[model samples]
Target: MRIAFIILLTLFYSCRGVSQSFEGAWKGDLAVPTGSLPLHFSLQKGDTWTGTMRSPSQTRLDFKLNVIEVAGDSIHLQSAALGMSYKGRISADGEHVEGTFRQGNYTAPLRLGRYDSTQTVKRPQEPVAPFPYNVKEVTFENTASEVTLAGTLTQPKAPGKYPALILVSGSGPQNRNSELEGHKPFEVLADYLTRQGVVVLRYDDRGVAQSTGNFLQSNIGDFSRDALAGLRFLKAQATVDSTRVGMIGHSEGGLISLLLAGQHAPDLKFIVSLAGPSLPIDSLMVLQLYHVGKSQGMSEKQLAKVRPINRKNFEVVKSDLPAPKAMTQLLENMKSVGGASGTLRKELQVMLLEPYRYFMRIDPVPFIQKINIPLYAAFGEKDVQVPAKENQESLVANLAGNPQSRIKTYANLNHLLQPAKTGGLQEYYTIETTIDPTLLKDIADWIKGL
Candidate 1:
């Protein structure tokens, strides 16, 4: 598994004795759906004013753009990476700036005040070690489309064929390492499992890493084909014990794993889920938005509006209407409620629009129940990404009569199987560690038992 490269550009600005119009540090806050978050805009004069802007406490939010754009009292910054944009006016003192934050279908008026840049600067975490395994980077064709897939095969270092397991990544355009927030869970897991005498195979999702395909164009069903192809690759490997082969999926990967086991059931021995969603994804996302809004203290009346507006935007995508038009209508509904007290309209708006089209149609029950393989599911109680209760409840409810299925719940762990403090997104960025060793242990024990 290869780690993704970090793009860090150090931009230099010219300082003049005669002095330029806009220079020095600019501090402010951007209003979000939940509340206002601090934004640090460090500007230096040259051809253009530029500097990196970070959120308060260095919240690991995906900003639209880190570069600062200054035009006299008017400041314009856009983060294409995060699909967010900001436009505001800087105070005459250059110490404060107030503007509107725009993301997809939502917009909010944001205010910011000047602050010292010397305040404690928090650094990011170290990358995790790759799972102990003999590795091979390979590429092959997608028989259906004849498109080549880039992937890595991590096997036990010792000789002799071993039970092989295919690793499936979670949501988003993930590479072979399953990199997220500077953590490479696939490498960590590959290393852990291989050392324990299991041969593992993990590949890049199409359109990510060296693989080929359009991520935005593909849906969950398309991803399942990729997983099956990976499995096929493993079965063809001379060093793998095909009879004992299985699948391990995390988050979205877990859902895919169930699909593979259910439909193909291709000599698969077992399956494992790490923090995967078992409920309908739309419902889960609604719960996420509601939880986030409540965490920021939205009142009952405000929440009432939040739910339906959220549901309409999310559910409408699955309707007969076109996705783009459905999304547009959803945004309008959100704007109608944006003025409500304590509601983060822009955040909800953006949140509702992008992920809605991808997740609204995903229902994992059909796949989960149809799977003939022995299933093992694990979730961290503190996980906010996939609510612990929702994941466990739905998985259990689906497998209620299936005695062969096993489920375990871990307390104080986050989505990545790391020990967590309430498992909030902030902790994911601030706290540094690969994953909890205990999680690895649980996985190994379960596999061995199976």
Candidate 2:
């Protein structure tokens, strides 16, 4: 599941009275407890100074600076959509900007220097061309949603019927590769599995790149229908063994897999849930807030004060009241949070969105308990986003009826399945490995055995 309120730092500069031009590229690394998060900015000076900032380690999209101000030697930049801001002082040499990055209550030191285009993050596991598999760009219609979904189909070159898997991405706007944090996880996984003689199909989420739909307006049920459409399309392929078809979901996708299987989707023989939750979503979210906040250096005292408020806010979200009423209750509940007014308002805006409201009301334990198909669920021991222990225990207890199910947790792995030190989100960009080799092998082996 996507952590809705988390914000990454960005770059900022002043256009007035500086010896050197701040119109080119600037780069910085925000130092956090886990590691450094690289941020980039491309600034342009014209009739009005305009700039765009990129968080390379988190996402490739550039956020437009909503506000930029200059006072003496101080530079301040803000992005209202991101709930992020930066304040810095330009070095006398004009080659560096030292600043403090703030997002909500979190703050960290950021030092930016003139960017060199030659330096780029390396992702060793991303597959290159000249593969031993056949790749084809395909499109299918989710007639139920009237959305034309696009995806990639990879099959072994040997051309024999193989066990098929449809990859479902986590919450957020994702392409066929499920790209994030400068990493294309679904692309790498599809390549690995296809090379292992399995037919793999990975699609862009509805309203994402190459797909047609309104993403922000859609909910989880809409995505589940889209995945079902992919499954039907895969089963019709000549190189796929329809009886052996299954789904491999990550995060929210994992919850979708359980939902489909619990409803007994046709021709779906097995499922693999990576960092999927089996607990009530409200409880899971509260746990997520606690763990992620602690990992980001939130004190015990602060966390204690925030916990009950968050729970009450979630209760408001899950209620049957209309949106306006729900939002009023959410705001009233947040009065106790007592943070910066701007930050509180930004966070309330997210909670009032349709997706957050629907997600908070869902309890996946009932769906997990109803599944009888072969299931393989894995978690990262260091994953703060999902908090491995409690989720794993819930899955273990609820899935006892399914004797074909298996659950395992890998030590030192994060939500993305990369080997990590602190399991914090910042580490996702720094870690070079896309997915753990062992986990890949485990997934392939389990599916083939089934």
Candidate 3:
């Protein structure tokens, strides 16, 4: 599953040349019940006022402001796509912008000051170079998709023919490091595993930084082909033992691994799944919605009210109808159900996109039951995105015939395997730990043992 950031932006009052003063960078801390989220805004005065916003704690990419307007002493910024807006007034000294940030049902006070370079989030587990291993920048092609993927490959310095792993990222357009919330989990995983004498290759998703192809137009099957291309490239390397190469995937990546293994892809000896689903996609998403909503402090009554609507929406997407027809049916169902706000309608429209529609129809149990190779699956106990208990049970039941398969769940860990409290998406930015240390060791040990 992907974690999306809804970010807000702000401009400055145009009267008295205040807008010119705001043409530079500004920063702010948005206070929420979980913790503070750091946001940055960069405004530029061109033919027309233009600006971009970033939430450094959640994502590194800047979101372009869709609307920027100034009315008297007040300034407003809005992004219809992200469902976010900010309204604030410029201070007398033109040094501060006091505003309220709104995204969906969440709103909080925000006060922006001059950008400070020193204030940055710390990720202790992110690897730094000192040269114990040989790292290479590599590229490969998926002939089926006509995409060239780029990535980093790390290997032991004393590399002979050794066991190799291809790291597959979760959903969304991610770089080679699988970066999120200012943390690079894939880099750390590659570093630790390479240090343990394994060859690791992690790559950018198609159309993500340094890669070619349109990420938005791709689905899980297309990604699985891309991963197969990676496996083919790794097997061709002289330093890798062709029979000993395998895949290690996280979230959606994990599902991709399962797909390949079930299909009995060549040279893919084993697989590891991190928070991959074993149940049907529709059921899994419904559970995810319930758990995530509860973790965000929604009342049980409120959750109960939306549960049926969500089920109906998923059912519409899962149907075999054409895309346009399914979307029309979905809209009619929501209208009949009532209470769906304009914001929710927009979000539902996103579900009609090919990616979500394909995802909702997947039944991973069939794939899980088909796997005969050695497999290892891990889940975080506190992972609301892919809850452990139900998925674990489904996997165990489906993989019963595969005695070589192993499944584990770590306590107090969130979706990213960080030790967490509530395991809410907002808390992911606040937690300094990237991937839990114990889980990292466990993964390496399991792969090496195989």
Candidate 4:
């Protein structure tokens, strides 16, 4: 995960006559309109006060509150890299730091207390040790790429030729657990599925955790090859019913399933998609950006200025122009429209541009139309990243030729399939439930039916 560099940490330093006991761990939740973000601060006292802040849920939030000032009861910390300044008043009891977190024209109330890891929301469904199912730490080869992938294969103890599912993760580098904010959604899902007479393969992404190969160089197709390798490995196993093997993927993983289904090889019995985009990636990305900005209360006028710049950038990538020429055109267009300024922003743009070029060009309609296997596609009604309405409409429209396709939209669910009000990515970490129970049951039953 790339660091946002836009810091949201608030800390408190000791004022003269205010207790030295105030200088330890401090934590706060920055409540945005979408959801709450947890901030952890570690303070050390030397000749001066120094501290680092961490956003446990997001890796992009590793920032130090180096510039700190303490005078009387007031504390000031500035991180220009993060484009924010925090000014808070430490309570006399040295318990809380009440402050206003300011960045640009936006200001929000921030309250920091003695740091507590327990403030993290609970995930009740996460599995514990001594599980009823047997779990094996297995390693398999993505024979096409010569990369060895490591993952946990979970199956029921009494299993005999059990139906199996390969769990594919979303975008970004993720572990076998698919861990985020102390929640292991994949672990929970795998456990739930395995307990219900289904075997599951949940692996780390390429170059992630124990897995090998350079993840930065891989596109969606590379990941699908890895997943297909998992399927082949499972098929050879005596305990797995090769004829009933299916692939279930989340987000980009879901898109990978579509890519694999078109192959019609290894005889994929079924495929399940969770919040997969049905439209072309370029169109989906445009809507995704718009939805996210709107959810965060961005004005339509502001969107009008930004949307055209985003479209032009994608167009340049899609064009026949050389990389240098495309980049020049993209930057010139951004400058002309008064959008995406600064050295940091431009550097990030260039860095991310190449990695998504293949994804941006993927046309899923052809893939869906060619798939002969039974398909179960689920979308969260409130998902902004892959809007439920647009994706579902496209899925039904494109897969109309496929008589075995099943498409559904879950109300009040977000991109993560957690029950949500706003469907914002920010809300993902805050919600206690990882994947909704009904959704899990729906997926399991569909796979079983196939």
User: After best superposition, candidate 1 residue 197: deviation in angstroms?
Assistant: 0.8
Give the CA lDDT, 0 to 100, for residue 111 in model 1.
55
lDDT of each: 0.64, 0.80, 0.78, 0.73
Q: Whose TM-score is higher: candidate 2's or candidate 4's?
A: 2
By TM-score, the best candidate is 2
**Where is model 3 poorest over a 10-residue stretch in terms of lDDT?**
4-13
Give all TM-scores, in the order shown.
0.72, 0.81, 0.80, 0.77
- TM-score-wise, the better of 1 and 4 is 4
Cα lDDT of candidate 2 equals 0.80
Clashes of each: 7, 0, 0, 1
Clashing pairs in 1: 28-112, 29-112, 33-344, 64-79, 65-79, 131-191, 132-191
Candidate 4 residue-wise lDDT, 1-450, digit = tens: 111111111001232225234477887766332123456666667899887777554443568886877777777876666667787777777888777777565455566778554465678888888999898999999978999999999989994789998888877666787776677889999999998889999998777667899665677788888998888888777788888998888888888888788767565788999987788877776777777777777678766667766666666665667677776676677565443443323332433344556666777878887778889999998888888999888888777355667888999998888999998766876899999999999888877776
**In candidate 4, what residue range of length 10 has the lowest lDDT sum?**
3-12
lDDT of 2 by residue, 133-156 (tens): 899999999998899999999998
Off by over 4 Å in 2: 6-41, 45-118
> What is the per-residue lDDT of model 3 for residues 1-450, given as tens digits with 9 covering 90 to 100?
642111100111122314425666888766432123567888777889898888654447789988888765577998775678998877767778867788886565677877544458889988887869999999999998889999988988884998999999887667788877678899999999999989999998887678899766678888899999999999988889887899999988888898889888988999999998788888877788788777876678767766776778789877888877886776777664453433344445556666667877889888788899999999999998889999999998888466667899999988888999988877876899989999889888887887
